[model samples]
Target: MAKAFASQGDLTEKEISFTEIGEGLYAFTAEGDPNSGVIIGDDSVMIVEAQATPRLARKVIDCVRSVTDKPISHVVLTHYHAVRVLGASAFGASQVVMSEKARSMVVERGQEDWDSEFDRFPRLFQGHEEIPGLTWPTTTFEGRMSIYLGNRRVDLMQPGRAHTAGDIVVYVPDQNVMFTGDIVEYHSACYCGDGHFHDWPRTLEAIRRFDLDAIAPGRGDALVGRDMVNAALDLTGDFIRSTYRPAARVALRGGSLKDAWDAVRAECDPKFSDYAIYEHCLPFNVARAYDEARDIDTPRIWTAQRDKDMWEALQG
Candidate 1:
């Protein structure tokens, strides 16, 4: 636990890197932090997932500015996580887009989630005071929506529920690149506190249907080449399965929460110990896995108090 806090205070924010994944498509990845994608169309730019705060998003905006001067007309939220969507205001996009389910989740539990996440990962929320409020999508869709940036077409599709009920992937067809939020983490720990463990594998399958040459995951390095893309997706799927199945099995056998937590830790930590945030996410992942395994469909809402209590129970 002390080792986990060792890097917790290392909050030296770095410059955002704009990597050209494909033609006019770039992935803006910070140093092992949450990532945002950029799609440059003929006329304007579309940003996927805002950073934790306006100040952080400005760094992403600065990266975009270096590549193109196009106005960011749209900000697409992959899900409603505070680290991913709270920076929407900084983009100043005319329309902030999200799935209908995500928008509803925000309306229902956004404040609690914001508080919970801020406490859990203080480094990500460097400028929490500047957050305007809960990020509400100005426009939302049910299944899928297509928007053309001049001739470049960006497809927003809810392949299935993985990270959250409203996880959406931004697909650029011409480039065969997909910007998958937390659904596929490349060498980064998958945060599964609000995830759908059973449906996550199916969601990964849906993501594989696309002929993706490159994948910009929610965190870590941008995956290039089909092999790396497939590997990332497979590794993420494996992590989810390894975390949930063993915990669920223990819970079904009437094991205590601590028992299930130990089971999942034994199974997952060895393989994923070297991944970023592995220690931080394991406790929450085990808790959620135990709940879902016991037929708790809707994940229990995590408030700030609940976060502290759970952390003490599991990690203390």
Candidate 2:
């Protein structure tokens, strides 16, 4: 490859912030790295989105320890991305939960996603030796499931396919706060390599209808009010549309992948260049958007070699 992916050069450590969004709801964010959500129930706690490795997961555990001594009994994965689910062992939760489709993806492409992610961003996988193996959900649900942390109710529902075919959001009705996984991002580039560009907006509407008071987004700071929450949603929607529109146009015109990349950059760079992981995500986003525009519904799995091939080709 002529050069490494932008994330390959992102070795600098990010400062972690644990912010409370509601009475017992918190968001654990690390700059633009994947964010984790903490929900304190009447008895135990529920975690959303485990980090990449056990070592990274410990950072979230540490934050939990600082706030409450309640044991983490449930770990709800929002999707099947390796960065979000491979650290379940660290939580030692009694139940690790995921949507049925997500569990299937883990079985189908879990290893490939892990390898491709390691190639792209090594910092997130600091404790590669401690990963044990692919993380699997002990509990799986079809569309929706409600788990009670004593009196507190946590609803895990698959709103629609957006970030992935099995993306789910953890909603706390009592607090009016939702832990949206990669379905929503703030100021950070959405990794569309395994995303549904067309369905994402509709899924966002499903979430917006909840009129959440706050949101713990996938990769940015905790949104604590309606204005901030709306801003994050708007930014996420704009980013997706800007990237896909130009790429779709290129694909419709029967242009090359490189041409699609160029068109997407011309449209997105001006608005999203400063967002975290922007450069790293652009090529993959364009590739998927072009594929979707070409009428491919299911996203093709990404492998380490495929990552390099796509990166190298776009370097032209």
Candidate 3:
């Protein structure tokens, strides 16, 4: 019998946690589901990584309303993933920001990604019809952009490509808190369907240079305190290496994609099988790793058709 398609079978709603990890900083995490980071300034609020849809994002908005009356003035897109950006309209932010590379990705494949992801994870896109359309950024920066909310400073930087070609991190120097999108997940599978495996470690290294007191990752729980933050970062780096290395080795040896998948499972299952979305991500992650290992520089676009074919080929 064929396995359930992607996350189509995952319909259970997770318990949400809205926690303040630092001064006026909040993380909206749902028990291993996608997360969003909230940064409250003196006058306004800045949200990092919008939820999957406007209806789903409203829950996050409700959480924000519970804390402050400040209007959301900035919506930051860490990358151009549907689960992260399609909810931009819910924020009503004056400025929607993302890296130039990320913006380009949205222009190139935003619609395809939207369609592909909705089919892959129906549960995440519960209010799919409510999504106005493709999410476009009002501002696009190259390397770094500094945003000042009254006196509080928030720095947005694209360290390097990891989760996507334009993955960005939100850093608050004053609080020493960072919001790393899918670049570094905590106890959650890093979706590598559009990742840069060879460059992910380098990107992770760049993030390590910061003295982080806390980190709000793309998924899983928020990490507070320096020790826990460091551990989370280290674990994320380890996960990236472990997932890609074996598949990469197999690919380099001219093995079949199945061989690469088998290699990855042998190496990762023992340690990461219990992680959220581990099973859902393995096929896609292995496919990307195999491509990167064989020196495929740019990640191939994942259309709905491609997602189905890849799943059946590997997990069927």
The numbered model that scores best in lDDT is 2
Candidate 3's C-alpha runs over 4 A off are none
| TM-scores for candidates 1 onward, in order | 0.96, 0.98, 0.99
User: By lDDT, highest first, what's the ranking?
Assistant: 2, 3, 1
Spell out the clash pairs found in candidate 3. Answer: none
lDDT of 2 at 101: 99
The lDDT per prediction is: 0.89, 0.93, 0.92
Q: Which should have the higher TM-score, number 1 or number 2?
A: 2
lDDT of 3 at 184: 89
The TM-score measured for candidate 2 stands at 0.98
Could you tell me the C-alpha RMSD of candidate 3 in Å?
A: 0.8
Error of 3 at 38 (Å): 0.8
Candidate 2: tens digits of C-alpha lDDT, residues 55-90: 999999999999999999999999999999888899
Give Cα distance to truth, residue 239, candidate 2, Å.
Answer: 0.7
